[model samples]
Target: MKFYKRTETRKINIGGVIIGGGAPVAIQSMTNTNSRDWKATVRQIKQLEETGCEIVRISLPDMGSACNLGKIKKNIKIPLVADVHFDYRIALEAIKQGADKLRINPGNIGSKDKISILAKEAKKAHIPIRIGVNAGSLKKVHNFSDNFLRAKVLSSAAMEHVKILEKHSFQDIVVSLKASNIDITVKAYKIFASKRNYPLHLGITEAGSIFSGTIKSAAGLGIILYDGIGDTIRISLTANPVEEVKTAYSLLQSMELRNSGIEIVSCPTCSRCEVDLIKIVAEVEKKTSAIKNLKRLPKPVKVALMGCIINGPGEAKDADFGIAGGKNTGILFKNGRLIGNVNVDKWVEKIISMIKDYCR
Candidate 1:
């Protein structure tokens, strides 16, 4: 059932987290809070940590913000990456403040000398640098009509930045080529991966609000990851960063690349459905979202919530645990066998109780 065969790339250490070189694809998210607000930033990061975010990035808009990187890093459990743009001094300050990594946009981070300075400092600090290239910010492309050509330009821009770092004997680097358009993003990553061995951080930049963003990121990241071309991912959404982390986990789990959390297989209610299947599934999700470390279970937990006997029985049999809904009652299946009947009202509680025991 597993469809992923990870692309092999050199490993880079950000804090203690290892990325690429066949490591499990790491999930990352950036904070939207003011970087100077250490308490708020730390609080958001802690929430992300609880939801399984392995790496967190914070934007450094000013010198004051860059100075607070260490304070924020001290309070969080995950790797901290300082996102810098336009100014190399901010990146230098971020390195001095003990940032685990630095993410710089190639288009605006300035001259080769500035890049060398950042490279030397980063190498001395032993921190990796992520060259984040975005299609909308490309300095080389003005008006390109072809997606493939745009992809080439994006890939070339990334390589040019990489060379600046590599020329200074800095090799601990990660790269991201992002475009709001899925096709351009995928093409850009493929071209870059084919030419180098640096670890890639995947994402769809400026992907709209939650509903649209999730679908776009899932489709784009899915294609790239399926081709075994990415090492890490950030589901950029115009929603809470927590949703981004959750979406990243869902995408990875659906591909069989990760085994964590509850995987719900619920049916789209049909005319035959006699129970409120939608409400039941929503209740189950709400209750189980608080379950910590479900990955510690022996295997991924599959919970099915089917509305009728037609596809219910089959899906329930295939899942680790499930409920096939009926008029006022439901059929419970656990470990591929009928456990017994339970009233529809108790389905959510039953599933939660079973998961707790299974996880234990």
Candidate 2:
């Protein structure tokens, strides 16, 4: 349950949020909005913050987008990181605009002098830089002649960039070695962690649509985190970035790494189900999602929605509150003990009301 003792790494502050060094693993998501539109980016970021995203990354594809960091940073509560590639100037402009962190590859930025200049500026600003190495782009630096060398190649390329920053005496650094393939992603991070203690940003890149991507991310991130190899995570999906945050929280929650919202323990409808359990669960989710963002709540609440006796109360016996569906009726219970039976139509509302009062 302790997840391999949470490997200790150097602590670095992205804005005011501390990551690594035994801190709680932070959830991060990137904004898909065009960065030049500061207002739009701010809007999306606020949604991310509301959904419990602690760090937000936005792309700085050009100077114009880089210039908008100050404006966007002013409107969001979470720390902002600029994702920069190929251009050291955009990285500089992002820093000057008050970006909390920079994700850049020193190797890809240019010559030694350019990297040194950027590192010096970042050092003066007291900000951290992430050496992001992707499997797709790393081929330029190393030969991919053998599949067995992929993980080592990825880790080595990242260290090569880290050396560039270290040469300039810049130590505030984070690193990510991501590949679309889960096995490769996990191996890359494991190999890197074995070699150094820098904080790692984890994800299965280009991880498809929400349904498929969630499964892929969970499998990859689950194993990596179980090994205590990640300090932060971004569950990349092709859907809305908010979905990314939600999926990240779900993954973290399952790993017992984060406990932020109500945990639903519902059994999939079976042949024994005698009521419209699907509709009831959907309604419960919709209603809870609304109250989940309320300013005040004692703590996370777990509610079970069961359809039959086979695994209903027995399986979810620890649920704070729950209902087992029946023919036009429901059995309300608390911690597996029978409270009473009620009309199925009122089960959702009654459970929510009781939870609201208990939380108060």
Candidate 3:
């Protein structure tokens, strides 16, 4: 079954990139560096861009950092989003200095008048606004009775913010309702997605360090994207931002929604096995990390390096290329047909060369 159906909707341009209404799912990341430090911010953004991040968000904590948007925009190739909290003036200044998008939680931005001014400035600059609602920052009226209730409250708060922007004739908007709790986050997004046409940014806010965060993000994002609920995704982690980009792509790959770079398919060595499958897979992964521009293989090409022939060849019959173990020799196969045997000593080198040739 097709996991997603294209929805007819309006398009919002963040910098030169357009999202919504049948656009490719965009990947986004936030800068952890000090935004006021122009050199550091620009350097981090360039690194994210290099990793194929389509959009970057930076915190504008004060007027000084808000002023740095011009320099940051000048140096970066992707859209720049200003994450503003409680300060309408910073939102205004961020736009004046050329921010391509503004992320503001109107529920905390003080008053209706302030929300109006922020919306007007964003509308005047023709920049989209993202109404980011987090469970940690939800409105006080929410009782937090149950997971579903909390989601409902958060979703309502987000829609209210969107209406405030809409009041000022602002329609270029996106919405994100985030919660640390996986169930609540999923429910909140499903609730919001059902009622609105705005592009939703999917994430599990404050998902912990690398191992746990990756699991949490993959589970939460995997479920939502499969249901056709996400337009863009950010895998929030306490680890380095680079990990976020990697996790986002992995989630997309799991859904068969997209593919980027080399996808290694290997097997676990058993008692019947020979040859070091673990080391071989690791070495190949490290070597191919630099080739990111290859087009997706015409089909899903599996490269299997299995440990035993008894179950190996049959298990990997669908692979584009494969290797099964012999005593001190490894037999390579293409489309399940044996090609040749190579000694264990030269197996890693042979596999690496084969992958490079395939990529070429």
Candidate 4:
């Protein structure tokens, strides 16, 4: 069944890319490197761009790092965003130095006048602004019952920033309401989405390491995106940023919203198993890593490598191509029809050649 996205009204441009108005959901990631270190920061941005990150954000903690925005912009292909906190001056400097986007909470950036000045500079630069409100930093007036209070605070804070940007006639904007709690994060986004037309950036803030973070991000992002609520997404993890990109694409794939390169469907080896499915899947993943630019399969292809025929061919009948195990031999199938029998040792090489031929 085709999922219908609830397209938000506002269409904001981040550099040359548009967010909202039914655009393809953009994938975003932030650099963990210190922005003052140009070399490290540039290298990370390049790597993120290579990983299919449509937008990259850098933390601009002070004026010096904010000034480095121009240099960072010169080196990266994707639009660069400045993540600023409390200082409107840094936000202004970042715009002057070519930041394509600014992530700031106007309420925390000193005063309404200062926010206006920064907004004016951002408007003059033709850059979009993202009002990122996190649960950990809610304002004092927000004291609803803790049960639903986080969502209320996040939504209230985001709207307040949105108002400041709108007041200055700065309509190029996006909004993110992130919380470490999955339920709160989901609830906050639903509330904001119900009330605003600005593009929503989806994420579960401070989600733990690779394993835990992927689960949290997937659970929260999955529910929201499935409901047609997100315009852009980031799988925020404490691990390497590359993993974040991979997780984002995986989440998109699960929702049938986007696809990148190969989607391998494999089964866990059980007592009925005969081959090393895990090792083979990993090798296949590495070999096809170069095909990341193909956002969706040209033709739908499901390549399954299963441990045994007990549940193999039937389980993978939808696969365009697949393999099921025997003792030391395996059966290869294409579109659920048996193709040939091959030794288990040659499975990886044979699968790679078959994929190459299919792509051709």
**What number of clashing residue pairs does each candidate have, in the order they appear?**
0, 0, 0, 0
Best by TM-score: 1
Which residue pairs show backbone clashes in model 4? none
Best-fitting candidate, scored by lDDT: 1
Number of clashes in model 2?
Answer: 0
- TM-score of every candidate relative to the true structure: 0.98, 0.95, 0.93, 0.95
268-298, model 1: which lDDT tens digit per residue? Answer: 9989999999999999988888887686665
lDDT of 2: 0.86
Candidate 3's residue-wise lDDT over 1-360, tens digit each?
Answer: 356764444678999888877676788999999998999999988888877788999998999999989999999899999999988899999999999999987567778788888888778788999999888887552576788988898898898878887888889999999988889998999898888899988899999999999999898888788777777889998977877887787678667666665555677788887777788777776766565544345534457878877877788887878788878888888887999987877777887777767876
lDDT of 3: 0.82
Candidate 4 CA-lDDT value: 0.85
List per-candidate RMSD values in Å.
1.1, 1.9, 2.0, 1.7
The deviation in Å at residue 25 for candidate 1 is 0.6
Model-by-model lDDT, in order? Answer: 0.91, 0.86, 0.82, 0.85
TM-score of 1: 0.98
Candidate 3 least-lDDT 10 residues: 292-301
